[model samples]
Target: MSAFIPLSVPNFGEKEAARAAEAITSGWVSTSGARVGEFEQALADYVGMPRAVASNAGSSALHLAAMACGIRPGQEVIVPTLTFIAAVSPLTRYVGAEPVFIGCDDSWCIDPDAVEDFCANHCTLKEDGLYNNKTGAKVAALEVVHVFGNMADMPRLLDIARKYRLTLIEDATEALGTKYVSGPLSGKFAGTMGDVGCYSFNGNKIITTGAGGMLVSNHPDWAEHAKHLSTQAKSDMLQFFHDEVGYNYRMTNVQACLGLAQLERLEDFIATKIARYNQYKDALDGYHGLRILPFKTEAEGVRANHWFYSLYLGETDLDRDTVIAALQEQDIQTRPVWALIHEQADYPRNEAYHLEKAQDLRAHIVNLPCSTNLSEADCARVIDAVKALV
Candidate 1:
């Protein structure tokens, strides 16, 4: 009997165990331990950001980022249709802003051209800021998600932001070590490129802290205020006084300890991800009409974390769901891309701009298993199973 391969799983060893045990024994297992601050500092340094605020989840970090950006009610934030709902939900649910969904380009990231088209064609630049003429709402910010670890077109997006005088927030939950290979932003990490960026450390991420997140920024005030907002807006050190509405979103010390251990091996995990993706690419070559999606390198020097390897099944006989079923029959786990956010029932009234590419992508992309600890033998089995089905 063959072992079932999972879609994604955490990679942990003695270091994780040791750090977590230390935090648990120290009686600082909740949110007040020293490990949390250390982990936050280490992440900020790694991403080249001046400050980082740890939170309970990526969604909470995003809400804090939105609050820091002053996303007010009746404002609009441009987001992509092909990302996790968590990436855009906080903008609307927490801050009372509306989401203006955009399409994705070849990188499976926000299409800068689409963004420009929407802003230039449908918006008016008033003295206050850019406003959507149709909805009569101020276009306050652009929430860009680094989908599946691929870098968005930051240069173009930055130019658009500058022109419109909009805030830029990065939902870099899946792109922790990804950086630009070549460009002005070369050597800069994904989360650091935006005005404010958020990351996730869920169990399935390249690094795991069980469940955690971090909000980062180059601006001192944004970072400081975001931290204040996350810890229930405590106004004083000795008292439980809160001056404003705040969230109990701080990360636990135990989670931070685990994160520290995972962070130590992030580079190695990224290497393994790249190697496994390459192996899958080679194995699937000319095997079927199937195509293993490549990391975005449209720009001269863009390096991706190669997080989740996906297959485009347009040329294959099987559709996305069929392929997933076939893989399951072989005891290999596979899943389709997230349903387009605009098409989701919750966002029925949300405006979507030219979602053709996103719709097409959602129907054809199948995420494959690429966990860091996935063994060569298990990978081979997965490939063989898929080859047989195709």
Candidate 2:
């Protein structure tokens, strides 16, 4: 049997090891080290943001964004149901905000039309904020996730946000290097275009800091405030003083050093991903209704990271589960896109608007192995296996 082709995994090289050793020798492996701030600055400069705050996890950065945006108890945030629960859950679990689930378009991202529809018909534009007519909660924010590294409809979404006075948050965890190639946001990056952009460095993401997250914003004060809140609001570090509620969400120097190494190679990693994606796409050739879903790339006026590729077998008899099981038999790893968050038992009462596309995508889409270091031979093997199954 050939070697197991696992799903997306970190591609740490000698540079990462060298950085790890450096962090160890510095004797400042904790949050207070200089590396943490350096990492934050590097990320901010990379993404064209004024400032960035590093956190222990991606979810922590999201929670900080929600809190910084002032999503209080009596408010609701429009979120996409097709995303990882972390995108919307932070609004619900951390801030006392409700989520009105929106469906995905062909882009597998929050449908801006549905959001506008909800806001126009079901919500009332009031003096201070937009209010949901039925629930009477202030519609405070709009959180959009760049699912599978595909760019969302930022132009229309931006117009909607401006019209409704919504705080637009970009969950750019999966879209680190994705940037617009054309349109009004021509040179803007996925996270940089929005008011607040949250990123993740999980092992499975385009790049890994082992486990860490960064939050960036053009509003430097928000980043500073988030940094203050992350370090337990240390009003007087030497005096052990605390003013408002805070969290222990700071990223350690060890993680930051690793992240710096990863960041340096981000563009190279993205190129690798793009190459493998094209290999799979050309090799598969859409037989039996099986084709890799296209990201909003050059043709669509965007330069996507191609972070993770989703195989569409919706019209194929092999189906999502069947393909997953068959690939597992060959020691290849794959998974379904995501369980619809609204369909989850925890969010039964929450509103999910027109999830027809999202539902169909969830039923038939299977994720393919997209590791940055995936070899040419491994790519061929995956393509061959899928073709044989079809």
Candidate 3:
């Protein structure tokens, strides 16, 4: 039997071990340490944001961003359904805001055109905000995820936000190193483009800190307030005075130690990811109905981190589940894209607009093994196995 090629996993080694040891030896392994603030600064500088606040998890960062956006009860925030539920759930669950799900386009991200259409046809421009005619809820924000390291149409999305006065939040959990390569916003990283950008450091993500996240923004006050709220809204640290309800969402120094080491090698990891993606694309080229879904590089000028290598199975005759099971038999892990949020039992009452593309993508897209540590020979094995199955 061959070695098991698992899905994405953390790529850590000597540097990570050394840093974690240092954190432990220094006796500052918890939240009260210099490394945590230093890690936040490093992420802020890398993403070109003025400030960043580290959190215990990515979902907490999203929740903090929602609170910072002032997403009060009954308000609406536009989101894409074809992404990890963590990106949309915070708005509804944390801030009591409702989500208006949008569809994905060729970039496999929130379609800017659909968003514009929804705002124009289904909503009314009011005094302070855009109001949905059907639900009569104020459309307060637009949270777009950089799906699989592929950037959404930011130019068009930004224009729509400006016109509608919507607070723009970028759910960049899976795209820490991805940056726009061309046009006015070229060189800007994924989470830095919007009013507030959220990043994840999960085990399967491009970077890992065991489990952590960061919230960044151009506005200093927003970051400061988020930092304040994350620390339990402490008015006076010495006296233990609390002003408002807050969360204990700060990341530990131990996690930050791992994150700092991971950040140092982020560029190298991105290079590996791009090389593997190109190798897979070249190998799969002209192979019947199977096609590798591409990142939005040419159109959006994106320097993609290539988070996940997605196989578009729409044109293929094979059943998605059958292919997955076959791959499992070969000890290679493969999984389909996310189930649309609106279709979930919990969000049955939420509105999803122009969901054709998102629905189609959900049924056809299969994510392949794309860990930064994936070897060339292992990659080739995966490709050959898929080809044989097809």
**Candidate models: Cα lDDT each:** 0.90, 0.90, 0.91
Q: Residue-wise lDDT of candidate 1 within 213-264, one digit each (tens)?
A: 9999868899999999998999987978899988899999999999999999
lDDT of 3 by residue, 154-244 (tens): 8999999999999999999998888887899988899887889899999999999989999998767888888989999999999999999
Off by over 4 Å in 1: none
Per-residue lDDT of 300 in model 1: 58
Distance (Å) between predicted and true CA of 124, model 3?
A: 0.5
Error of 2 at 36 (Å): 0.8
lDDT of 2: 0.90
lDDT of 1 at 347: 87
RMSD of 3: 1.0
Candidate number with greatest lDDT: 3
Question: Per-residue lDDT for 88 in model 1?
Answer: 86
Error of 3 at 87 (Å): 0.6
Give Cα distance to truth, residue 356, candidate 2, Å.
0.3
The TM-score of candidate 3 is 0.98
